[model samples]
Target: MNARRGPAWTNSITSTVRRVLAPLAGSGRGIFGTAALLLLLIASGYIGWAKWGDIIVRRPQYVLTADCIEITPQPPWIHSDIKSAVMRDGSLAELSVLDPDLTKRVVQAFELNPWVAEALSAVKRAGKTAPRVTVQLRYREPVIMVRTRDPRWKGDCFWPVDTEGVFLPPEEFSSTQTKAFLRVEAGNSLPAGAVGTSYGDAGVTGAALVAAALKPVWSSMGLEWIIVRQELPNDVGQPMEPTYILLPAGAPVDAVAARRSGRLVSLADPPADEPSLEVRWGHAPGREAPGEASAAEKVARLHQYVAANGRLDQLPPTTVVDLRPGAAGTAVATGRPAQTR
Candidate 1:
C-alpha cells in the first residue's frame, strides 16, 4: 500500500512541472523567430544598397554643373573657364561620390592653380535637388613687377611677383593690372615662365620686402622706380652686399638746387632733359649688413630727413643720403653743398 501511494505522488509532481514549462517554451520560439526576421531584413538592405549605390551617385538631381560653383573675391578675369577646368578635373563628379577625402583633393587642385593663392574650402549643399558646390578662393595679387634677365629671352623680361617672391603668369595679366604696380630691378638672372614658382633667392626676397614697405609712400612721395644693386665684397673675405636706389618720377636732378646759403631752391620750370634725383637707400629691408640699421630704421630716418628739409627733389642733385645706423647722423646727404643751418 505504501509503494502504490509513492507512484501516485510522483505522477502528480511530473504533471505540475509540464504545465509550468509549456508557456515558456512557446515564448522562446517566438523570440528566436523575431531575431531571424530582423537579420534577414538587415542583409537584404545592405545588398540593395551595394548594388544601387553608384546609380544614386550618378543621379541627375545630384549632379553639379558650372552654375553650381561659387567663388569669392571674384577675380578680375572670367571665372567660367576655371569652373570648366574644375568640373573636368573630377571636382564635380557627383554629390554622393564626393567624400571628405575627395573634397580635400579638389581643394588642393584649385590651390595649386597659378591664379589662386589659397583654396579655402569646397563644400556640397545637402538636401538639394540641384546640389551647389561652394568654393572659397583667395586670388594671387601682384605687388611688384620684377624685371629679370632670362637666358631664354633676348631682352629683359618682366614678371609679376607677389610679396613672397612667387612668380605669376605674365599672360594672365591685363594691361591695367600690369601698369598699376611698381617695378623692382634685382638683377635676378633666373629663367622665367614657370608660374607659381618662387626664386627663393635672398636678393629677390629682400626686394619684395622693400617694395611692400614702400607701397604706402610710393605714390605720395612721387617715387617712380627702385633699383637693387649687389655690391662687390669690400674685403677679400667679405661677402657681397646690396644697395637700394630710389628714383623720382619725371623730376630731374638739376631741377632742384642747393643754394650757397644751404637752402633748397626749386627751379620754376626745369628742363625735361635734366636727370632725376636718386636717393641712396643703403640696403633692402631685411638683408641689412652687419653694423647697419634695419630697413625700417633707415626708412624712418629718410622720412625724417625729408620732412626736416622738403620733398626728395628739394634736396640737391647727386645727393647720397646715407641712412645706415651709426652713419655720421640721421642722414649724411653727400655730393651736395653743405647745409648752413
Candidate 2:
C-alpha cells in the first residue's frame, strides 16, 4: 500500500513529544504564551488557597460577639434556657461582629431563636469607639418533642412544643407548666433524650403566640392562656357551641409564625424588645391542679357548665373537662378516659 508511507515518520512519538512540550515553558519561560499560562496557574492556586485559608490557621485574639438568644422570666422556660449565652453561627464569644476578616465568622455566630428563620446579623460602628453589632431577629415557628403519652391523645400523645424543647429542663415546667407543649404522656416511655414538644401541630394552639404583635388578639380575647382543643372535624369539634372558634389541630408552622407576628403587630404600641409571654390555652389559669381544659368547645361548655353550677374554680388544675355531652346546664366536671396517642 504505497510502501506503508515509510512507517509515517512525521507522526513519530519523538515528534509528538516535542510538539506538546514546545507550547509549555521550556528553559526560557520569560516570554509570552508560556509565561501567561504559568501566571494564570499561580493566580488560580493563590485564590483557592486564600478562600480556604481559614480551615488550617485559626486566630484566638479576634472573636464574634453579641450572638446570643434573648430570654425572659415570664415564660420561665425562656429564662431557664438562656442561663448562658452560646454563639450561634459558630463564632467565638469575644470576637467582633464587624471585623473585615471575620465577616464569615460573624455570619456563623448567632444562636438562632427557635422562632427565627432567616436571621441576619451585622457589625456597625457605635459613636466611634466600640463596635456595635446589631442583629435583626427573625422568628421561626417553635418545634416540640414527644417524650410520653396519655390516653387522651388520638394516637401518640405528641408534645407539640417549641424548637428549644430538648434543651429545657423538667423543672422549668414545674413553675410555668409545660402542658401547653406537645403532650408526651409516657415520659418514661420516651426513648433516651427524646423530648415531646409542639413542633408538629399548631403547637398546643395558643403557645405559638410568643411574639408581641399578637398581644392585641390575646388582649381582645382576654385569653390569659390559649389551649388548642385539637380535634378532628366530624367527631369532636362539630357539635360544640357557636360562640367558640374551632381551629383545626396541626396548623402549618410557617402560618403560625406569621399569625404570631401579625398579632404582635396588632398590639397598640408594643416595645421594640418585649419579653415573651407565658401563653397557652388548655390548662386552668391557676397554680394547683385546677383542671386543664383541652378543647375550646369543651372549655366553653365547661365554663358554661361551671357557670351553671359555680364550681369552675374548684376543678383540679390538670384536669381537662369534657363538657360536650350534657354540659349545657350542668356544673359537673367529668373525667374522660386517659388515652395517650
lDDT value, residue 121 of candidate 1: 88
Best by lDDT: 1
**Per-residue lDDT of 1-341 in model 2, one digit per residue for the tens?**
56554333333533554565576656465577566666655665565557644542334422334423232222323433332333532434645434465534543443333323334654444433344455444433333333444576554333334433222334334322443333322112333333322233332223333212222232222223232333224455462211111111232222332233321122233322312221223221221123433344344553454344333223323323333333344322323224321
Q: Backbone clashes per model, in order?
A: 2, 73
**Cα error of candidate 2 at position 36, Å:** 20
Candidate number of the best TM-score = 1
**What local distance difference test score does each model get?**
0.61, 0.35
lDDT of 1: 0.61
**Candidate no. 1 TM-score:** 0.67
**True-structure RMSD for candidate 2:** 18.8
**Candidate 2 wrong stretches, greater than 4 Å:** 1-62, 66-76, 80-84, 94-96, 99-127, 136-167, 171-184, 191-296, 312-341
